[model samples]
Target: MAAAPSGPVGPNPPVIAVVGPTGSGKSDLAVHLALELDGEVINADAMQFYRGMDIGTAKISVAERRGVPHHLLDTMDVTEEASVSAFQADCRAAIRDIHSRGKRAILAGGSGLYVRAALDVLEFPGTDPAVRERLEREHAQAGLRPLQERLRSVDPVSADRLGDARRVIRALEVFELTGRPFSSFMPSREYFQPAVQIGLDVDRDVLRDRLAGRVHRMVDAGLLAEVARLDAAGLRRGKTASRALGYAQFLKVLDGESDTASAAEETIVATRQFARRQLTWFRADPRIHWLDWQDPDLVAKAAGICASPASVI
Candidate 1:
């Protein structure tokens, strides 16, 4: 755990990080917690940043939010790229504003990388445009694996912090510019403001059931129509926005490559796999207080943890 700076801020209530696998009801918990604590939620999901990506990303609707304030969701369109550094910067600023206003800030989502980056994955280098262009070209030609391997060699430290996609791009950039892995510049660890983290989870059977039910509801909610709309807008297959679960599968269906049942099947399988990956990423951090989905007082427990004295945060 990183030490809190010795200052007046030490006595303040901790910022809360709500994390968990998909289909875990994390967003519901966040809204209720925010209401309880006079807090506002800041999105930590990478996918939820884009506008018109509501259904696929499972973004909270205004009605679902129950009048609680939220931030960072729908802050960008699919055409624009969002990154961890930009998220980190925006989140830090938001946290500060919340503190100043005497309100709690809740960071919520299943994207472990975004949450971790906002919390402590600091001292990592920012992107360089020229290097990014060159590396992007390389990635376009030779593929991401080679770039990832290059990252593993030069900047294993930084590479280890990034997921495969980010690692590959950044490593290639570093290699192109400096003939080295981008890892050398990374410090062992960097500090962040004190924060309480809670990860929500359910029994495997329960989780799968919830996921399947959600997929069925999405089908009813015109998820296929939504995908067709995106396609009509020219967001084609290979673009990041089009790669979201259900979208790609539906697009294939739209393109006559598969049928509705096949698309739904593929989407459901992919969503479950994504949930598993989310679980794997977060389980590494022992700092996150794990709460069972059935825990009746889960919100209270999380609030208690946020206010505890032993919190290294």
Candidate 2:
């Protein structure tokens, strides 16, 4: 691997990863830092990578980005089942290009796993078709509960956060095939790159209130309209793209199975649950350096951390 780029240890050639839960204001923070630090934003969010997923994914807009260089947002279609490898390649290229131009690369998003993949030198164990087939059979017979139970037995930490059936099946596949816990293969460095991390923090109550408000705003911002357009575009039902939080839930409304009110409520609930999972993921990571989302000196604190011995030495 190439050596970490040389620089003054703060706000420059090195990478700065800004990661936090949804509604934590990470995207805006990255944009601001980029403007101040000669940086470009590298998206690490899984959902935001897809096109026509703007509002539901809480994607940053061109206007909101304020002429700052942002990479990877809205870079894929919803029909594409993107992977960590694909994101890794794109991120490496973006970062390399930014460095060649003598600017910082700020990776900012809510997807902890993607962030880790980019920052850490992780070796994901190879997939085993037999293991995956067996898991699928078990899931088909007993539904997802048993598979989820098996995952908890093997890698409780990952299982606890990844509670959904699909995630559980994938985790079990990795464990069975690798003969090791999923977490064991993660990068030695928690942040991927040795660059500093600036985590966004907000009061629990404040964040909840903000989330609620954002949900309403999303509705007013044509979230339903966007979902309709996606449907019109022929994204299949149950496909990953069709299953995006707001869009999927609303599709049921459009299908006459539920009312708009109920779908909106379900979307809110799912979004909040996803945020909780995001918090769990970020908390488990030790590389993050906290930045109070409301603090008047957040940027200063981050700048200090970036220049500190822990970051530079």
Candidate 3:
């Protein structure tokens, strides 16, 4: 086991967040930093919250965690929808508990919004079930075109930025319920607490290759079987989990709409696109310290940063 570094010279060491695109090795880096800093991890990956979403989400195995404590993984049922507001509260509580025990809290994962909700001074607009249901009905009746136009009229910025129907409908619902543009609640680059964000920088071509290999490995590792198990557990009814990259593609296979090989190919393509979006989201934040994902001494380099004064910012 690696020995942890000495206590921070400065008062109040900030929470450490390891964030980057999918397959950039954020989870492994989090474990390494935890071992060297007396830290526990708080998961920010939205999909990893589901109990049986292991292979597709690339969740760290028990052995891989290497005895480091992790919070928020496998905490939700497949049928449950994850709320960022709920996650923010849980994450803050976990961080406080970790700090009280004199341990660093390392927040890790690639879900850009979840990560921001956990570490930034952001608030989710309250939801109205009635408004949501109405919009959902409208979408079911006429599809995304009508809703997209409605959103573009009321909140053009959000509509332009959100390409997915779910997000667009939610934005419209927010506008209806709050009587304000959904983008008005957009968080500035302000931290909810003291924190340091470390981002993994990977070469685009290398990342694409890595992503394809990862999807292939997931298939060989029984991603389809995992999906079957979850599908039996009502995965199809789970709005969020059903839309996950590999899960979504594999679901089609299970539905007799496609085969494993074709589904795997689709998954690789979708995952690559998702990675690009992740990079775009994380790159917009100026506070992140980018380090090469392939660095030979990544753990040591990261540890040094955690021990330095910059770690508190």
Per residue, candidate 3 scores C-alpha lDDT tens digits across 1-313 of 4665734624356889999999999999999999889889999999999999999999999999999999999999999988988999999999888888888999999999889888888979999888889889989999999899989899989988998888998899889888999998898889987888889999999999999999999999999999999999999999888899999999999999999999999999999999999999999998998899999988887877777775656
Model 2: which ten-residue window has the lowest total lDDT? 1-10
How do all models score by TM-score? Answer: 0.86, 0.84, 0.96
lDDT of all the models against the reference? Answer: 0.76, 0.77, 0.90
Candidate 2, 154-245: lDDT as tens digits: 89887777767666887888887777877666567644445677788768778877887888888888887888887787756424677777
Model 3 clashing residue pairs (backbone): none
Per-residue error for 22 in candidate 2, Å, reads 1.2
Worst 10 contiguous positions by lDDT, candidate 1? 1-10
Best candidate according to lDDT: 3
What's the lDDT for residue 271 in model 1?
A: 91
Where in model 2 is the C-alpha error above 4 Å? 1-12, 128-138, 145-162, 175-183, 190-192, 237-239, 307-313
Ranking by lDDT: 3, 2, 1
lDDT of 2: 0.77
Model 1 bad stretches (over 4 Å): 1-12, 142-167, 177-180, 183-191, 237-239
